[model samples]
Target: MLNKKKELYVAVAVGLIALGGAAVFASQSSSGDNAAKDKKPPASLTSVTISDQQATHIEVVPVKTYDFVEQNEAVGYIDFNQDATVQVFTPYQGRIRQVFVKAGDDVRKGQALFSVDSPDLVTAESTLISTAGLTKLTTAALERAKKMLETQTAAQKDVDQATADQQTADANFRAARDAVRIFGKSDADIDRLLQTRKVDGELTVNSPLTGKVTARNAAPGLLTQPGNAPAPVTVSDLSTVWMVASVSETDLPRMKMGQSVSVAVMAYPGKIFQGKVNNIGIAIDPATHRVGVRSEIKDPEHLLHPQMLATYRIRVADPVQSAAAPLNALVREGDGTMTAYVTKDGRTFTRRAVQTGLEQEGNRQILSGLQPGEKIAADGAIFLSNMLSLQSR
Candidate 1:
């Protein structure tokens, strides 16, 4: 019975050893499978190739490092520099007797714009003439009184009264003359009115500065007055104009006074207007959350007109250091990854995913996934991508 029991125990120990060996083998097999699944495929294994004869048709260049500006684009419009614009009004109530200029006319300073028949001018001129006559009469009387006193034929009281009258007449004459001058009449015209004794009620309105007439309300026989509806005319100096732009809240941080800007107008395509930021608004619009930005552009050629649609690009940052690639070298893949083809030898070109930065002019900035000296397809990268796609299919 003792020998049979020992035999059973030996059989059970052998079975347990076999089971342990089998479990170790299965665990080793599973770990090997997982490592194979996690391994990434080599890019050279799937790289695209072309013959030397085909390579002559395509151009390749080394990736370059340079400084690039990050640009922010905004829509804007050409506007008048309010400081250089003027809305002219007549100085007195009157009827427009004649119109000498029209809208769109270039006018010089002191150029006659229109003439008005003013009753106020008539009243002022009449007072001036009366005062001139009275002053002349008082002066003659004063001279006679002085001569009589010198010969001891008149009392001192008589001379003193005459001198007082003369002084009073002079004060009245100056007041009347100034009133006529206030009605847009020059001092010389006032003198002529007094000298010729002519009562001229015609008042002429003149341009206050050199500019182009942008609006006109003057017409023959129209009743007009100072501060009436629509000024007599609007003149604007277009030598330097304002470009008003609304900047998004996201881009407001990029704007500052004196920042350089480039403007393009639909009126003259291909012509770029240069300007600088003159002002930035303190208030942000509630609805759009955009701040107002005003840039002053020199339009000495008068090529830009007010209210014209314009596009603005602002350079907000100093040029940044980055790897630059030709725009033609970049290819956007179906997976939305930006890629470029790189090659160590001319025959085998591998696909490399590159992170892109600012794209301006024709140059694109490569933020990552490319070295400075790596060779890339400069002109025909898209064609290579297409060929690779066909082969994969």
Candidate 2:
């Protein structure tokens, strides 16, 4: 039985060795297959070429030179030219009897705006009439007195008394006439008043020029005086509108009188009004440190009104030539600086720093740090940034 057990153990060991050998061979075969697979190149990396179909989809823009105008941008508010603003006030205390025009009404020169009731105006008118009547009567008396003195038919004392009476009447009449003239009353107006019974305080206010009424102070039945707290009305000529703007000190050197300017009002967007620089303020504001500029726009149709807010762009001659590039070519860095990619070859790009100037016509001005004819990556700059990030990682 011991011999049989030993033979059985040896047979078991042999079977175990055969199984171990088979397992080792299978492991080596699996490793060799893996090595062969690793030696083969990936399909994406080996001898790859873009297909004609893909090449047709690629787009490229050639670099070309273009004449561009450099412009400066600023924000400002609008104002009426002070010279065109007219403040109307009453010259005498009176009740407004009738208002011929209302606010926002257009008036012509010498047009009667409103009439007023005032005792002072009446008094002046009546006195003027009396003075003229007395002058005529005194002149006849003086003539008769002179005739009597020359003929010696009347007493000399009688003639002298007549002459003295005439002189006194003449002096009083002249004084009254002068008073009427000072009150803006015409001679014909005074004569008409003399024909009627004396009426106190009746006068009319008229517009001094053709303009639009911007403000109204004296309403019907309102009391007004010469030195009232506020002006009775305010009028402005709309034939020519004013665009007032404040320019920064840095840009003031480029501004000059008679330079062409274009203005846009918020009320009328998309419409451009053209004008010329009429005035430039000599003094700069201390608080804002800006200078005032005025442009005159022709408004024959009266579309523009006073006090309307507008933005003005003045075209001044640039002292030096500037470079410009497509807006998409620039990339802003995390540190607040901007960078652009310059194409060295068709496939490679180099990073370049650039300085910017005014943006006009959908292109940004490159003030410095970039030369013309340098091909810049106008598109896919973000892809380049991502590539750089991957390289860093």
Candidate 3:
């Protein structure tokens, strides 16, 4: 019985040994499979050899030169063209009797913008009326004295004294008339005032030019002084506007007067405002490390407003000759580098990294990693990159 029990224990131990070996073998097999799955091809394997059938799908062309002009971009704001703007202020001190126009109102040359009840005009008119009455009375007295002298009823000295009085009155009336004219009274207006013995004290201030009003601080009964702050009205010719750009100081040397600029604004999407650099700031801003570049943009429609956000691009340099690759010949890699599929034998293509510059037309300016006359995949480069990535993985 003891021998049988020992044999039974030996059989159980052998079965347990076999089970342990099988488990170990299975574990090793699983680890080998995982390692094979995780293995990646060498990164140096960037070249791909394809059959003629595959080569037919890719459009390969020789690299050529392109004319590229460097441009500087900047953000800025829209503003009024100060050269065409004017502040309309009353020339004389008076309480505003009437404001004929408000902000945003269009005005023409010689159009009355406002009227002032001027006390100076009133005083001038009063003097003119008194002088006119005195002249009429003195002339009648002189005529009576001349008639009486002819009849010997008055002495020659009396006649001479009346003539002198009449002459003095005439001179005074002429001076008063001149004074009223200075107050903007026309000849006809003065004549009518003389006939009616009435005065029009309100003075009309006319616009100096054709423009649209930009601001209005004038109201009825508002006291205004000459050339004061917060001008009663501001007008500007809307045929043009200003685009002010803050350009980096490093780019200041590139900016020049009369350089053409293309501007865009958020308010008008897809519309370009064409302008030219009219002024450049003499001093750089210490806070922003930038300089102000002002451009005058034609705005015939008067659509641009002050303080609108805008952006602009100014071509600083002339066009330069450089190698250009077809736009589709390059592909952006996952590592953020640009890669082009280069080929010497036409069927065997290799990935070449390149540095690019301005993209104009359908070509990209190749600054480095490429040469003119080299064969590159002009199209279907993205396909090659995808195939290469899949095979490498």
> lDDT for every model?
0.90, 0.73, 0.90
Model 2, residue 391: distance off in Å is 22
lDDT tens digits, residues 196-263, model 2? 74654657888887888888887889988886767777778877777877889888999888988777
- Report, for all candidates in order, the number of backbone clashes: 0, 3, 0
Candidate 3 segments exceeding 4 Å error? 1-67, 128-197, 321-330, 340-355, 359-384, 391-393
Report the C-alpha lDDT of model 1 over 64-83, residue by residue, as the tens digit: 88788777899989999999
- For candidate 2, what is the lDDT? 0.73
Each prediction's RMSD over C-alphas, in Å, is: 9.8, 7.6, 8.5
Q: Distance from true position, residue 392, model 1, in Å?
A: 6.9
Give the clashing pairs for model 3.
none
RMSD of 3: 8.5
Better of 2 and 3 by TM-score: 3
Model 1's alpha-carbon lDDT is: 0.90
Between 1 and 3, whose TM-score is larger? 1
- Which tens-of-lDDT digit does each residue in 1-393 have in candidate 3? 999999999999999999999999999999999999999766756988878888888899999999987889999999989999988877677889999998889999878888888888888999999999999999999999999999999999999999999999999999999998876678999999999988878887778889999998989898888898899888889899999989999999899999989888888887888999999999989999999999999999877899999999998988899999988899999999999989998888899999999986578999999999999987789888988888787
Quote the lDDT for 352 in model 2: 66
Question: Residue 120 in candidate 3 has what lDDT?
Answer: 82
Best-to-worst TM-score order = 1, 3, 2
Evaluated at residue 281, the lDDT of candidate 3 is 96
